[model samples]
Target: MPDDCRNIYKTCRKAAGLTQEAAAERLGISVESLRAYETGQRVPPNEVVELMVILYNAQHLAFQHLRETNALYSSVVPEVRPRSVLEASAKLTNRIFLFAESHADRRLLRITEDNVIDASERAEFNAIMEDLQEIVEAALELRCARESS
Candidate 1:
């Protein structure tokens, strides 16, 4: 489903009002690389996909917050397409794991280690809980964007 991923990436990028070059710069990649990903000439690596998910979620949240404050009405609205909640959620889960693995703070490490023992008796599932929160928040924001349009 690389084509689907490319389409989703393009939609999210446009929704955030970011040109391919701008998005690539933000993602610390080359514009040609971003274009390749968008055109399905090359599939983004897992790390790049994770970065995209973070960017998409952050942008979605910003737009949602703007709309809530009625700030969006003052400007000319850009086109925004809907995103799949399930796909977003899955991406968020991957992002959380990536974050945890990369920046293993003591508190997070303890909580994560505890969760590995008997999933039902986990001491703190904050990471997973936060992932769920991001998913819900992103979905709500996307829904708001859709409804507003």
Candidate 2:
């Protein structure tokens, strides 16, 4: 698959132990259509992607497709690089440790104590939020990897 294809649609199909013709038939799509999506020649609709996710038993594919296709999601969501369950668990543990060591909980409490983020606290608040997002992303990735397993 081309690197620019964004999501590994084809790879996921193959990983599910299916050939092009077989997967296409299961997806209820023409082989040419599936090929187009895999080759980056066309973007598969959300429904088709959803079908692929279920048919392939790959939850990560749904998240990857969303991240790649939705501009707002792409901007705000952390990129979830595919990794083994072990790798994802380690990443989550590291993120949690870093967050805890940084006293983000205290900072967050202080920042929101007044139910508002004053200008002075905006940067710190953003950093905490980003850290939290990383933790969530790691957990989600782990779930996806476990599902595939």
- Per-candidate TM equals 0.39, 0.90
Q: Which candidate is the best by lDDT?
A: 2
35-148 in candidate 2: lDDT tens per residue?
Answer: 999888888999999999999998888888888889898787777767898998899999999999999999999999999998999999999999999999999889887887
Q: What lDDT does the true structure give each of the candidates?
A: 0.58, 0.88
Candidate 1 residues 1-149, lDDT tens each? 33433455677777778899888988999999888777767766757766775666534433422333344532433323345656545555666575567553455556666456456535445555554455555555456444434
RMSD of each: 15.0, 2.0
Clashing pairs in 1: none
Whole-model alpha-carbon lDDT for candidate 1: 0.58
Please list the residue runs of candidate 2 whose C-alpha ends up more than 4 Å from where it truly belongs after superposition: 1-3
What's model 2's overall lDDT?
0.88
Off by over 4 Å in 1: 2-5, 58-149
